[model samples]
Target: MQFDKPATTNPIDQLKVVGKPIHRLDGELKTTGRAMYAYEWHDKDVSYVYGYPIGAAIAKGKVKSIDASAAKKAPGVLTVVTTLDVGDLKKGKFNTAKLFGGSEIQHYHQAVAVVVAKTFEQARSAAALIKVDYEEQPGIFDLQAAMASAEKPDDSQEPDTAVGDFEAAFEAAPVTLSETYSTPDQSHSMMEPNASIAAWDGDALTVWTSSQMIDWWRTDLATTLGIDKEKIHLMSPFIGGGFGGKLFLRSDAVLAAFAAKAVGRPVKVALPRPFIANNTTHRPATIQRIRIGAERDGKITAIAHESWSGDLPGGGPETAVNQTRLLYAGANRMTAMRLATLDLPEGNAMRAPGEAPGLMALEIAIDEMAVKVGMDPIQFRIVNDTQVDPEKPERPFSHRDLIGCLERGSKAFGWDRRGAPGTRREGQWLVGMGVGAALRNNLVMPSGARVKLDKEGVVTVETDMTDIGTGSYTIIAQTAAEMLGVGIDKVAVQLGDSRFPVSAGSGGQFGANSATSGVYAACVKLREAVACKLGFDSEDVVFENGQVRSGNRSVPLAQAAADEGLVGEDTIKWGDLTKTHQQSTFGAHFVEVGVDVSTGETRIRRMLAVCAAGRILNPITARSQVIGAMTMGAGGALSEELAIDTRRGFFVNHDLAGYEVPVHADIPHQEVIFMDETDPMSSPMKAKGIGELGLCGVSAAIANAIYNATGIRVRHYPITLDKLIGELPDVA
Candidate 1:
C-alpha cells in the first residue's frame, strides 16, 4: 500500500493498544538469557568450530605475504585461509574499507587471515602461529592537519549551500559570534560484538549474524563472496545492541563464511573487542567552525557552519553541518562539509551520526551567540524558531513545535531560577543550568511485511525489521494488535530472517515508524480479506472484540478463516510527501551541572528533555530510548573519545579497558516528555523518529552547563578536567 496522501482518521487512532505504556514484549526472553545472540547460535545436529582472525599490524601499505604453514600444522587446527587465498575481492556497496581478502592494508587490524579449529582456545593458539609481512607506507591520520587537503565529498548531495549573501549580513549585524569546536572520534561500544556463524550445504551458504539490516547484509555478502544472491540465507533474530556498529557486514561474517566453505563445517567468528575499532567502522573526528550574526534582540540574521573530517578513500564526509541549515531561521545562511582522505578505520553511522556531532558544536555556538546578545539561551532559541525551512522559504515544516518544546521545558526545569555564570555555589561546588534546541530529520523507507491469521485466531507478523534494543517487537506487536482488533497476547512477531519480507531494518530511528507502517498496510489487506469472506461491505465492516460486525449481523473473526489460514503481504511505498513538507523532529534539552572549584571536575546534577516528535507509539519504549540516548550524550560531553595515534594512523585506545562510556551510575536523573502531536505526512502511523532526536543537542547543553558553572568555555568535546584545571577558580 502506497502512502501517497496525508493520513486521515485511521484504525490506529483507537489508542486501545498502540499508545498505551505496554511492557516490552521481549523482556522475559532477554532477562532469562533465552534470547540468543549471533555468537551463541546453536543447533542440535550441527557441530560448529571456532574461527580466530589475524589482523595486519600496519595501517597502510601492502601485505607482502602471510606464512600460515605453522598454523596449518598446529594441533586441533582445521584450516587456515589468508588474504592471498581469496585475492582482492569485490567491495560491497555499504563497505568503505575492504573487510578481508586483499593484500592492500587500508587500515590497522584489517583481517589478514583466519584460523579455524575444534575449539576457541585452539583457534586462538593457532592464530598466533601465523605471521604476516607488510610493507608500511605513511598515512594521513589527522583531521586538523589535513584541513587544507580536504575536498568536497561526492556522496554529499549538497556539499555546500548558500542563501542570501552571508558575508554582507554578518558584517552589518550588531552582535556576532564565531568559534571553532572539535569532536573526537567515537566508538559504538555496544554490548554485542560483531559475530557470525556461517555454514554451507551443496554450494548454498547460510549465515546467522548480528546485523541491523538483514537484506542489506545478504546482498552485500553475496557481492563480497562473488556468488548468486539467491544462494545465501541470513538470520539475525536477536541482537543485544547495535548503535549502527553492525549496520554493515564486518569481517566476522566474511571470515566465517570463507572458513566454513574451506573446512566443510560450520564456523563461528567473533571479532576480538580490542580489534573492533580499527577493523570495523567508527564515528570520525570532526573540526567544525560556526559563525552566527544576530540582532541585539536575539534575532539571527546570518548563520554559517562548515566542518571537516577524515576517512579512508571513497568514504563520505561526516556532514556535521546538516542540522544547522534547517534548525533555525536565518535569512543569510551557508553550510559546507569537506572530507579528507585519512587511512583510519572506515567512518560510518553511529547513533544519530551527522546531527549528533553537528549539534555538539552548533548548539554550543547558539549558546555563545545568546550570551553575546544578552538574552536567555532558551528565549534566544525560541526567538529563532522557524515553521518553514530556512533555506527554502517556500517549503513549510509539516509539524514543528520547537518553541513549544522550549517554553514547556523552560517552565518545567525552573529556568527562571538560573543565575549568571559561576554565581550559584553550594560549598565547593558551583551550579548552573543550560538549554539547547534539538532537531533530527525524520526519514522513511519502503518497508514490507507479511501477516498471517490462523484458525486459532492468532496473528503472526513476519518482517526483516530488527529490534537493536529500541523496542521494535513491542511497538510492532502493538501496531498489528491495534489493526487486527486483537489483544497483544494473540499476536506473534518473527523478525531478522532473509526469508521474511524486507523492512526498513532498524537504523536512524526510522524502523519504528516505517516498519510498523508496513505492518499496518498488510493488516489493511487482511481486514479486507476478512470482510469479503463474511459477505459484508469492507467499508461498513467493523472489527472489534474478535468479531466482525456489519449492521445487525456479527460473526466471530475466527469463523472467517476457519477453512484455511488467511494471509496478507504488502509494502508501504511513499510519494512526494517529504518533498512538499519538511519533516523533522524537534526537542529541547535542559541540563543542570555542578563543577568543583578545587578539582575542576564537572558532574551532572539532573537533566530533562522535552520532545515534540510526532505521535509516540509506546511511551514506555520511547522513554527508554530517550533516556538511553541522553546517557550516551553525557558520555559524549564528558568522557567518550577514541584516542588516535597520529604517527600510527590508528585509534590507540581500541578496547573498552582504555575507552570510557558512562552508565546509569555515572549519569544523574533524566526525565523525558513527549508533546501530544502527530504528523500525517510522516506515515500511516503518523509517528516520527524520536530516539536520535533525544541525542542531538544534549552534549551542547551539557557543554553550556559546564561553561555556566565555571565561566570557562570549552570548544572541544569530552571536556576533560585537564583542559579546565589551570583556568578553574581557586577555592579560598
Candidate 2:
C-alpha cells in the first residue's frame, strides 16, 4: 500500500485504541522474568558451550603471534577461534572496523579471539590463558591533534547547506555573537550488554541476539560470514535497552556463530562491560562553532554553524550542523561539517545522534546572543521561528508549532520567575531558569508488514520491527486493533524475526510512526480481504467488533476466514510529500537549576518539555521516550563523558562507575506535555516521531540555566563543576 497521498478519515482516526495510554503488552512477561534475553536462551536438549572473547591489548599494531596452547590445555576448553583461523574475514557492511582484528588492530579492546568451553566460567578463565604479542605503533588518538591534518571522510553521511552570504551578513550586523563549544564522546550504557546465542542445525545457523535491527543484522552477519543469507535466522524479541548501540551487528553475534561452528555445538557469548566502550560504537566527540547575527529588535539576520568531529578511517561525520540549517529564520545561513581521522572506536548513532549534541551548542549560542542583545531568550527564539526552511524558503513546514510549545512551556514552567544572573539567591544556592527551543526533523522510511486473521478471530501482525524498550509491541498492536476495529487483546504482535516482513527497524526516531503505519496499511488490506470473502463491497465494508458489515449484510470476521487464515502483506512506500514539505517536530525545554555558591555544584530543580510532534500513537510510550531522552540529556549536560586515554588510544572510562549517567537522584521533577495536533503529510497515522525530539535542545537549556545562575558561560560539554568553580563569586 503506497502512502503517496495524505491520509483521510481512516478507521485509525476513530482513536479507539492508538491514541490511548495503553500499558505495554510485553510488560507482564518482562516483569515476571519470563522474557528470554540473548544470553539466557538455553536449549536443554542440546549441550551448549560458552564463548569468551579476548580483546587486543594494543590500540593499533600488527599481530606478532598468538599463542593459544595454554588456553587449549585449560580445563574444559573446547576450541579457540582466532582471527588467524578466520583469515581476513569480510567486514560487515554496517561495521566500520573488522570485528576480529588481528594483524592490524584497529583500536584497543578490539576482539582478537574467542575461547569456547563447556561452561562460561571455564571459557572465561581459559580466555585469560591465551596470549598475544603485538607491536604498538603511533596512532592519532586526540581529535584536536588529528583535526589539524584532517581530510574529508569518504563516508560523509550528510552534505553541507548554505544560503545567502553568511560571513558578509554577520560582519555587517551590529549585534552578533560567535562561540565555540565542545562535546566529548558518550557511551550508550544500556542495561543489557551486546549478547548472542548461536546454534547450528546442519548448515543453517539460528542466532538469538539482543539487537535493534534484526533483518539488518541477519544480512550483515551472512555477508561477514560469507554464507548464504537464507541459511541464517536471527531473532531478538526482547531488549533491555539499546539507545542506538544495538543498531548494528556486534562482535558477540559473530563470535558466537564462529564458536558454535568450531565446537559443533550451540554457543552463547556476551561482551563484558569493559568491552562495550572500545569494542562497539559510540557518539563521536564534536567541536562546533556557532555564529549568530541578530538585529537590536531580536531578529536573526545571519546564522552559521561549523562542526568538526573525528572517527576511524572511512567513517562518517556526526552531521552536527543538520538542525542549524533549518531550525530558525536566517536570511544568510550556512552549515558545514568536517571529519577527521582518529584511531578510536567507531563513532555512530547514539540516541538523537546529530541534534542531541548539535542543539547543545547551537541553542546555547542563541542564549548568549539573546543576553548580548538584552532580550528574553524565549522571545528571541520565538522571533526567529521560521515557518519555511531557512535554507530553502520554497519549502514550507507541513506542521510547525514551535511558538505554541514555547508559549505553553513558559507558562507551565513559570518563566517570569527567572531573574538576572546571580540576582536570585536562596541562602547558599543561586537559582535561575533557562529555556531552549527543541527541533528535530521528522524522517520517514518505507516500512512493510504482514497481517494474518485466523479462524479464532485473532489478528496477528508480523514485522521485523524491534521494541528496544520503546513500547513498539504495544503500539503496533494498538494500530492493528484500531484499524481492524477489534479489541486490543485480540491483536497479537510478532516482531524481531528476520523471517517476518522487513520493517523500518527502530532508529533515528522513525521506527515508531513508520512501523506502525505499515501495520495499519496491512490491517486495512486484511479488512478488505475479509469483506471480499463475505461477498461484501470492500470499499463500503465496516469492520467493527470482530464483525464486518456491508449494506444490509453482516458476518463475523472469523467466519470469512474459517476455511483458511486470511493474510495480507504490503509495504508503505512513501511519496514525494516529504520532499515537498519541511516535516519537523518542535518542542520547548524549560529547566530550573540551582548552583551552590561555594562549591559550584549545579543541581536541577525542575524540568518541563512541551512537544508538538503530530498525533502520538501511544501517549504512555511517547512520554516514556521523552522522559528517557530528558534523563539522557540531563546526563549529557552535566555528567556523561567518555574520558579518552590518548596515550592508550581508548576510552579510559569504559565502565559505568567512571562514566556517570543520570540516576533517580540526579533527575528532578520532569513534566512532559504533548500538544493536540496531526500532520497529514507525515503518514496515515498522522504521527511524527517524538523519541529524539525530547532530547534536542535539552542540554542547552541546562547549560543556559547554569549560566543564568552563575553569570559564567561554559562552552565545553558535561559542564563540569571545575569549569564553573573558578569563575563563580567568591565565597564569604
Candidate 3:
C-alpha cells in the first residue's frame, strides 16, 4: 500500500477503537514485573555466564600493550579477550565512532577488553585485575574554543534556507533584537542501561538485546563481526526507556558475542552506570545566534538563526536551526548550521534532538522580541503564525492550528491574570506565567507487517515495532481491531522479533504512526482475502460482530477459515507526499513558576500543553507520552547538564548520582489538551507523533516564567539559581 496522495475516508474513520481512550494492553505485564529485559532472558537448556567490559582510559591515542596474566589467574575467570587480539574490524555505516576492534582509542570509555567468568561478580572482580597502558594525545574538548574551525555540514535533510535580502530587511525594520544563547550537552539517562545477551549455535548467532531498531542493529552487528547478516538474529521484547539512546548497535552486544564465542558458552553483558555517559551518544551543546526584525505593529520582517556544535570527525551537526526555518512568518529569513570536530564522545540524537534545543533559544528570543514591541508574548506569537511554509510559500501545511493551541491554552491557564515582571507577589515568592510555541517535523518511513487470521476468529499482528514507553503494543492492537471489525481482546500483538516483518522502529517521533500504518496495510489485505474466500465482492463488504456481510448474505469470519488460517503480508510504501506538503506537528506550552525572592530558588507551580497533532490513537497512552516529555522538559530547564572534563576529554560526572533528572516531588500540577483534529495527509491512520512535540519549547516557557518572576535574563540553558542570585531585587 503506497501512500502517495492524501488519505481519504478509510476504515479507521469509523472511530470505533482507534480513537478511543484505551488502557495499555501490556500494563499488566509491567505492573506484575513479568516482562523480561535484555539481561534476564532464561533458557533451561543453556546456562549463561557473565562478561564485564573494560573501557579505554585515554581519549585519543593507541593502546601500548595489555597485561592480562593476572586476570587470567583470578577466580572463576574463563577468558579475557582484548581489542588487540580482535585486530581491525569494519565500522557500521550508521556509527561515527567505531564500537570495538583495533588499537586506536577514538574516545573515552571505548571498549578495550572483556572478561568472562562463571558469575557477574567474578567477572567484575577479575576485570579490575587487568592492566592496560596507553599513549596519550591532546584532543579538542571545548565547543566555544573550536567554533572558529567549524565548517558547514553537508546536510541533505535541510540545507540552509535563504530568501530575499535578510540584512537589508533587518536594517530597515523599526524594532530589531539580536541575542546569543547556549545549551549544554546532556545525557539520555534512561531507566535501563545498555545490556545484551549473546548465544551462538554453530556460527548462527542469536542476541537478546535492548535495541530500538532490529534490522539496523542486526545489519551493523554483522558488519562489526565480519559475518553474514542472515546468520545473526536480534530482538528486544521490552525496553524500560531509550530516548534515542539505544537506537543503534552498542558495545554490550558486541562484547557479549565476542566473549560467548571465545568461551564456547552464552554470555550476558550489562554496561555499568559510569559508562552510560562517557561510552554512549549525547545531545551536543550548541551556541546559537538569533536576529529578529519586526515593525511596531508586531509583524516579523526578517529572521535569521545560526548555530554551531562540536562532535567526532564524521558526526553530523545538531540541526538546531530546523524550527526557525518554518515556525513563524518571516519574509527575509535565513538559517545556517556549522559542525566542529571534537574528540569528545559521539554527539547524536537525545530526546527531540534538533527542535527541542532550537526552540529553547528561539522561543525565548520570541518573548524578548514581544517585549521590545510592547505586546503580549502569546499575542505576538499568534499574530505571526503562518499557515504555509514561510520559506517556500507554494507548499502549505497539511494541518496547523497553533493559534488555536495558544488561545485555548490561555483561557484554561488564565493568561489574562499574568502581570508585569516581578509584580505578582505571593508571600516570600514571586509568581509569573509564560508561553512558547512547539513544532517538530512529521517523518514517515516505509514499514512492513504480517497479519494472521486463525480458525477461532482471532487476529494476530507481527512486526518488529518496539514499545519504549510510547505504547506501541496498545496502539497496534487498536489498529488491527479497527481494521478487522473485532474487539481488541481478539487481537494479539507480537513485537521486537527479527523473524517478524520489519517496522519503522521507535525514534524521531515517527515510530507510532509509521508502524501502525504498516499494520493497517496488512489488515486491509486480510479484509480483501476474507471477502474473496466468502464469495463476496470486495467493495462495501461490511465486517462487524465477527461476521462478514455482503448485500443480504452474512458468514462467520471464522467460517472463511474453517480449517487453514489466512495470512496477509504487505509493507507501507511512501512516495512524494511529504515533498508536496509541509507536514509538521504544532503545540503550545504554558508554564507558571514561583521564585523565592531571597534564595533565588525556583518552584514549578503549574504546567499545561495544548497539542494539535492530527488524530490521537489512544488518549490514555498519548497523555502518558506528553506528561513524560513535560517532566523531561522540567529537568532540561532546571538541572540536566553533563559536567565535562576539558583536560581529560570525557564526561566528568559519569554516573547517575551526579546527573540529575526530575523526580515526582519536584513536579507540580500539570494538564494536557489535544485539539479535536486529524491530518489526512499523515497516514491512513490520520495520526502524527506527539511525544517529541510535547517537549519542544517547554524549557523556554519555564525560563521566561522565571524572568517574569525575577527580572533576570538567562541566555544559557539549565537556568540555575546562580544565574539569578546577584540580579535579585533588594526587596520584592
**Alpha-carbon shift of residue 24 in model 2 (angstroms):** 0.5
Structure candidate 1, residue pairs in collision: none
Error of 1 at 309 (Å): 0.7
Q: Which stretches of candidate 1 lie over 4 Å from their true place?
A: 730-732
Alpha-carbon error at 19 in model 2, in Å? 0.1
Query: What is each predicted model's overall lDDT from 0 to 1?
Result: 0.92, 0.90, 0.92
How many backbone clashes can be found in candidate 1? 0
Q: What is the TM-score of each candidate against the true structure?
A: 0.99, 0.99, 0.99
Taking the tens digit of each residue's C-alpha lDDT, what string does model 3 give over 1-732? 999888899989997999899999999998998988898888899888999999999899999899999999999999999999999889998889998899999999999999999999999999999899999989999999999999988867464779989999999999999999999999999989999999999989999999889989999999999999999988898998999999889999999999999999999999999888888888999999999999999999999999999899989999899999889998899999998999999999988999999999999999999999999999999999999999889999999999999999999999999999989999989898988899999998888999999999999999988999899999999999998888999999999999999999999999999999999999999999999999989888988878889999998888887789999889999888778789999999999999998888989999999999999999989999998998999999999999889998999887878988899988999899999999989999999998899999899999999988886779898988888887786536
The predicted structure with the larger lDDT, 1 or 2, is 1
